[model samples]
Target chain A: MSQPGQGLSVGLFATCINDVMFPDTPKHVAELLTRLGCSLTSSPAQTCCGQMFTNTGYFREGEATVEAYVEAFADCDYVVAPSASCIGSVRHQHQMLAAHRPALARKVDRLIKRSLDLTEFLTDILEVEDVGASFPHTVTYHTGCHSLRVARIGDRPQRLLRAVRGLRLVDLADSDICCGFGGTFCLKNPDVSIAMATNKAKAVADTKAEYLAAVDNACLMNIGGILHRIKAPVTPIHVASILVQQEP
Target chain B: MSQLTTLPRDTDGRLTPAPPPGELIDMPRFPINARHELANTDQRNNLQAATATIRAKRALRVSEVPQWEDLRQAAKTIKDQVDRHLDSYLLQAEQSLTKAGAIVHWARDATEANQIVVDLVKATGAPEVVKVKSMVTQETELNEALEQAGIAAWETDLAELIVQLGHDRPSHVLVPAIHKNRSQIKDIFLTEMGQYGTPAPADLTDDPSALTSAARTHLRNKFMRSTVGISGGNFLVADTGTLVVVESEGNGRMCLTLPQTLISVVGIEKIVPRFEDLEVFMRLLPRSSTGERMNPYTSMWTGVTPGDGPQNVHVVLVDNGRTSVLADPIGRQTLRCIRCSACMNTCPVYTLVGGHAYGSVYPGPIGICLSPLMRGLDSPIDQSLPYACTLCGACPDVCPVKIDFPEVIIHLRHEVAEHKIRDTKPHLETTAIAAAGWFFAKGRRFTVMTWLSGLVGRVFKAKKQFGAHMPWPARLWTSARDLPIPAAESFREWWRRNHERP
Candidate 1:
């Protein structure tokens, strides 16, 4: 739990979901870190964290992905990922998933100590708020359940958002509840999943904010999909995109 | 009676019950039941309002106590001690109860327990028996057994009376009729109370007070006339042979005291090692259950006195499925539940779907763990109960004994997966997961797979996003919510294109 010195070295651990679907999120995260004066390195050996398999009760299958993740980031000072859910798995679940492999488990423990969710890297490691970016829009932030409860990243994302030049942050009702994008849960139980997502969508719409942003794109995907289906005016944006966007 | 004539006796000359028809797992699967329960708008509204109110009240009351965490830890430690040495505690409890003049009966399962109760009622020659709110009796379906034996069992608690009269199953553990609003209760009382004993007044209204008054009047006659009573114990003190019942309504007090012959059917997990152990539970139960500093009625009794309440007392210690639950190293923590229902109040799923969807006498998070263990997870419904939760962790946060609900749920999911693996044919989910695991094990394979999937996604893109309807296995994701179209270039591809130079 040691603090990183100024100008700390960081590895951009763009998760599989972000790598395949939302490439702009990682791009924005890289720009945000560069703006905050941290050196960024990209590892070509990185892939999925096996959160999907681990969460769906496939521990053995998930262990392989944990081994890949530990190997990918073994030498980095800080491994920063845009998704709290993936970082949560790396920080909390990697040891449990890798327990059968003692040597790999030790590697996982060391990797998790250096792993940080993007917000944690910004707030805790860099000690930087007010990233000197401007975005003129009223936005509501959805705190992913893993980030809020597991990582205990309370108000760090909001504090960073408030410091943006023209970004207005509105409160979301029941902000702490899960938005129902629980890895494979959305597929396993679609009926309940949509029911929960619809409630979250309505809460977001009620805020009348032009944009809904969150640390984890997986939740945003679920909420954003429903918003698009209902033809809501609000768009889903990654918090990193807002932090790095500069007015032309 | 005609029904009793059909009863068979065992070879040892005891009543060999007919397999205790309609035992646990009679209800439909959890998902099917939840689908139906979710469609009922009235039930959803009632549950939402009730759970929200109770949750807020509980939070306020629990926060007032500075040592709440210490109390919860103490409660957990004591329960673990009791569970660890449960064999010795049971023997000590039996010895102490026998010394106090209370007859103790040991029942292996539902049939034996029902037979013991029926024989006890027949010995007293009472045509009817009054009941305090007892979860063990509900778990064993004792009331139906008694009815078949020509004995009418009257439910005295207001909520249980509603469920009994309405011919409905109990939903929530603490509040059996939590799904019913005041007007529904009024209608149930008006139509059903008369057949049971006394009729509801002609001018009865839907007001809660008026409804409770009507229940009180109807139950008074049954309480005065019945010569036998049955109950479930909250906590059984091993050293003192004392049985405690914590309740809100005065009906429990009446049922516990008025009958001449009293029978208590309690789960073996309800025992604590010492009398002082009651202090932690007494404080935890009321606050976690009714959100009250102290419930209106907490009646504790030890055996019988010559001229005092219930001269002939019997204690039936039932281990219907508790021993099996205790055997699981990871799941044994579920037995620590005191049936407070705090987890139910805070659960978003329970608030939305109500308790009947769980298909067990115990509902909510505890039910999800307890029912499967008790029933052996052989049925589809038993397997489905563990997945009913979203793994929100709200239940574990508020649980008095701090049951790690999400951990147990994941463990059960693993059990289900392992069970499926044992079958000749592998499940589609298992196959898909294994395939994904293979790809994820190596970074190069994953990168190649993502590149190909993104290429296909780009070709199939209609109107710049995937349509609402998708093909077969992926349809599970698309049937409800639209999937975001994959990026034309993955982050890895973009990184390779921009940064990598030959």
Candidate 2:
């Protein structure tokens, strides 16, 4: 693992999904970092990790998006994103996607080494599990596939959740299987996707937890969407939001 | 024999070759098939229960092997070596088998392979043959061809027998009739087994033992009388010309030993260069496939066993698009598959929709890569197979040979898109992706689009917190799960208002 630069400065990569659909997630990420005594900065030039295009098989478009991303975060000490999917893309896919461009690939490799998912940045780099947050609600965490399998950020989010004051963390069955929000896969094959989502929703409901929290909002959006559509009692919340919660 | 004359055949007494193996298109697309399958509660339940049970057993068995990972790597390395030099290995296998008194024939495709089997059967002048469960035979649609040639092929494996009697496609590699529960098996047996061979008892029940007993009684008579036995080889040892069949039931053993003449149809990729390589595969196959520490019956024969096994031994090495699969550097890795079916058993999509949706003899994660490469991906069903996965990475995780299914799926997706581009079709997805790519290529453009989408999303907001339904292309998403409405304020905009720029 790369060492954090002097004085705790980090670049915020508010992944395109969060930037557009769940903007509050990046805000909470920022707030949580601030509470952890880190200085945060955002580049207006940053957009996405190009995961959408790459995963959907548009390599040319994915390459362009990746190039833009690398250009945006090239000089940052450590780039933090609230999304494991985006961080996973940057860390795993970008180098492959940009392999044709040797210089760009090298830059992506460097950026990937420095990139961290939100909880990863907190628990690993910041060395702070508890960020002085309080959320008194029964919650269950669904570890997104990329986070668990790719980024290998096992139990980091759960560890932080466990540290939250007044929070009751419950276990979700088969929490590691995908919630079926596989970018275009959900739309391309909705029946299978819906069946998988229905299973996930049932598992979440079985937990009887008031909130279903995960690192990736895209998964939450899918699981949360189904939960809301079926009028399930549980609601989806981002881990960053939960981590940044105060007495109120 | 009465049923044979109605089917058309050539003047040479050969059934007209079926369409080239991979070219038998027009199968329903995956989503369409999955839709109907999803509605079949019984199939869904059967698949869920069977796969879950097998998956647990497999995990436990695999965990018990302390050197499981090393064994998997060894298997992968051995298979990789085999694939890398398949031509030489195949020649070596042929030479070794011939030296051991086995007649070896090379089949370039399914049609030629079926022709070889039929001609070999006709030479025996036998109207009936017992078959061991072989995926290669299924891949070639050999039974249909043999029937066309006026040969009665009795499926001897219990699950394969159930599938044959029910007139159903094999839904899984390991358990051919996994979609059929005990009751379904009893129904198939009670109704159809009599017409084929020995009839089931009038009081046959859905109990597993009863079902097996019925199958045993039905197959036993055929096994006794059949002069020819047909099978699919699981592994072909190139060094000694040994063909190995790893199976649970004793049916494979019966088909191997009972008949005077035995023919094994094997995919060329099934070759393992060295006999010692079997050690790796033996350990991996059972644990990965049926979740057994070891399959109950493992039949190995090097040519004719003289006085013990069949006096006439013939092995047909079938290509059937395998060489085409081998030509692809990335896709050829799939050739390493030992047909453990571990990937299918663990795949979430396969578990839900069952194997019929894949529209190929092979299904699930391995099928997604194999079918397209073998069939040339021109068919709509084949094209859609690659997208059937959620890319959950489970299949690769459990793959004994470590085929990296998601990577292959993604690679094939690219090929499918390229194929579309070659056809000059208007792809909505391509257009939307291009537009998104343009937006992301420039930060200003991306920020503007994000703001616009957010504004539009808020404007169309419904009473529900998330958009209950969306229009057109987006409607695909909303049909199942609600699409989360874009935030009212873009994060960049919020950042502009509150935070200092870097």
User: Which candidate's DockQ is highest?
Assistant: 2
What digit string (tens of lDDT, one per residue) describes model 2 on residues B1-502? 1223232333334332222233335787888889899999999999999999999999999999999889988988998988888889989999999999999998999999999999999998888788999999988989888878788777888988888778677899989899999998989889876666578999999988988988888877778877899999989999999999988889899999988999999999999988898988999999999888988999999998768879999999999999999999889999999899999988889999998888898999999899999989878999899999887778888999999887888889889878776677697777777777888987888889887977876796664364545677677677767767677788988898898545
Give the C-alpha miss distance for residue A101 in model 2, angstroms.
Answer: 1.1
Off by over 4 Å in 2: A1-6, B1-24, B461-469
Highest-TM-score candidate:
2
lDDT, candidate 1, A162-232, per-residue tens: 99998889999988667777777777666677778988999999999999999999999999888888889
Single out the weakest 10-residue window by summed lDDT for candidate 2 chain B: B1-10
Candidate 2 lDDT over A58-133, as tens digits, reads 8888888787787777877799999888888888888889888898888888888999998888888878787778
